[model samples]
Target: MKDKIQSFFHLEEHGTNIQTEIIAGITTFVTIAYILVVNPSILGDGGMDPGAVFTATAVTAAFGTCLMALSTNYPFILAPGMGLNAFMIYTVVLSMGYTWEVALAAFFVEGLIFLVIALTNIREVVLDAIPLSLKFAITAGIGLFITLIGLKNAGIVVDSPSTLITIFPFHSSMQDGSFATGGISALLGLVGIVITALLMIHNVKGNILLGILITWALGLVCQLAGVYVPDPAAGYGSLIPDFSRGLSVPSMALTFMKMDFSQVFSVGFATVVIAYLFTNISETFGALVGSASKAGVLQEDGKFPRFKNALVAQSVGVLTAAVTGTSATTSVVECAAGIAAGGKTGLTSLVTGIMFLISLLLSPIFLAIPSFATAPALVIVGFLMISSLLAIDFSDMSEAMPAFICLFTIPFTYSIVEGMALGFISYVVINTLGGTERRKKVSVAMYVIALLFVAKYFFV
Candidate 1:
């Protein structure tokens, strides 16, 4: 069995083994498992059944991840993306005053468009056309973006009206005798970061996974000692899992095949489809390049192996998600945690998919893993990815300028597509104006992509 598994995954060929892949998979799962709780909560706000959305979220993640694993042999995992879901509910449904069903239909159309693009190799062409420096920049940019996510989730960073963003007030008091949830969580998050850093300094195996577990254990301890009190209204609940909801699999009846296509021919629907398609394409492309770069899997020509298969898998995932009562499923940046933990091939992805399926019956336990616990791993992985910046040609202004733009814009704007779009525009324009030699070096696809982005901003 072990030999067959090794041969199937080409484990040895990838310089990895089953054990390392398993650990990497678990680490990836731990970091991303929050989606199981978060996705349903967000969709529920839009009148979708939370129970059904929970089921869809897991099913979509499992199906897309496993399909990608089988087809592409890459470790990148797929899930309903955060920003895409927000746009679906807030922008498409609430703001536009459309039913959730219409939003799903719009996403369905977007998926069809993407599948066509994937099958025709258009998506692959665009990915291949991106400059190598921008690829590295995307990788590093994603690193910072996820790091900011970690810090924000753990309460180490908080919103500020005057400054826009600021550190959480670690010394605030609770007026009504409740715990200072934000402050304590931030303190614990900092402690977790320190613990993870210490583990890294010692060269401990599976340090990222250990950091999450140890941080969670500490939270549990604090809860027991009355140091960290549970206040659901305050957004700092208990660390304990509530098995009162039972371990049965959630029914998907409410959300299954619920798309409403009556509005498909409307002009507003076209805008929504265009928006979804663009976001899905750009975000998925960025994630794929970033993960491949981090995993050292990008070919010498700057194209990733099985690129078409990966896109086809993601597009299929998006279609499935639309029918299953969720938003577009795309490659997640969190998979970088798995790559950082030494995942090199599809075997790692396979394990993550299985874990998502298992969460169907064990949702409470998985949901019990707090955000702060995983925050440290993200922060550390972010640092690991930023190391790619060292390889960029900083002395060349044309390359360095776009790279710098992409690197900062990703985290600042909180949008991967926006960052990549601006970077591509900068890359093409800067090179075209540099000299005749530089203009000759730029690809026709790059020029086309840049122009499309400009048109999107202006007209769309």
Candidate 2:
């Protein structure tokens, strides 16, 4: 069995043993397992059933990660994306006043579009058209975005009435012995960050996973000591739950096969579908390239060797998400956590998928992990991803400016699509004005993309 498994994954060629791969997989799983709870909570705010969304989230993650492992042979995992889910619930359903069923239909149609594009040469063409500097910028931009998300989740950052944003009063309140204002959660997150950073500095193999477990243990201890007060305003203060009640099976009746496609082909809905498609494309490309580069799996040309297979897997995952009544699924940047832990092949993803499957029965345990505990892992992963900025050529103004825009705008605007759009548009405009040769170097597809994005921004 060991030999067969080794041969199947080319584990030896990848310089990884089964044990390392399994550990990497577990590490990756722990870092991303928060999605099981977070996704359901977010979608439930849009009037979907939390129990059904929970089941869908787990099932889609397992299915997508397994397909990515078998088809692309990469360590990346796919799940319902955080930003995309927000767009679905806040923008599509709430603001636009569309039913969740209609949004699912839009997602399904977008998935089909992705499927067709991935199967063709368009995927490679779009990838090739992107400049190397922009790729690195996208990677770094995603890192900053992830870090911002971690800070928000940990309650270390909050809205400021005076300045646009400001630090939470965790420290000030703690100094005054006040725990009512989310200081406890912030303190727990800080401890987790310190523990994880220390373990990483010491070169521990499973530092991330170990840090999460340790933080969770501390939360349990605090609960027993009666210091872990649940803050309803913090959104994730209920980290400890009664385990004696045992597991309750989740209901899938509300969300399973709930897509409504009546308005899919209409002009108005087509715009929404196109928006979803573009966001998914940009996200998948950034995540795959970033994680693969970290894993040392990119070719000399800085492209994934199995790009088409990865896209196919991602598209299938999105399609499955729509069918299961969730938002679109895409490659997660958290896969970098596994790569940083020395995962180099698909076996890591296979293990992660299996763990997600098992999590279906252990939902309560996984769900009880508060965002503050996982926030530390995300901050560390973000730092690892931002390290790729070293590859960008800062000397060239043309490349540096667009790259800088891409990197800074991602976290600032809090939208990956907007960052990528601004970057691509600037790249095309700057190069076009540079010289005829430079303009000629830009691909026709890029010019078209720039125009489409401009239209989407102004007209759509």
Best by TM-score: 2
lDDT of 1 by residue, 1-460 (tens): 9999899989999999999999888888876776776566557658998778888999999999999998988898999976577567655676567899999988888999999989895765655666778878877886787678778778789899999889876545555443356666877888999999999899765576678778889999988988887777866768898789789777899999999999887756765676577667767887898899999999898977788899999999999999999888989878888898999999999999999999899766646767777678768867976877998999999999999998898788765556767888999999999999999868997787778767757654
- Candidate 2 matches the true fold with a TM-score of 0.79
TM-score of each: 0.72, 0.79
Which residue runs of candidate 1 sit more than 4 Å off their true CA positions?
A: 1-54, 68-114, 121-124, 174-179, 200-209, 252-311, 325-352
Give me the overall lDDT of model 2.
0.81
RMSD of each: 5.3, 4.4
Whole-model lDDT per candidate: 0.81, 0.81
Poorly placed runs, candidate 2 (over 4 Å) = 1-51, 69-77, 80-107, 171-178, 233-236, 243-245, 254-307, 326-349
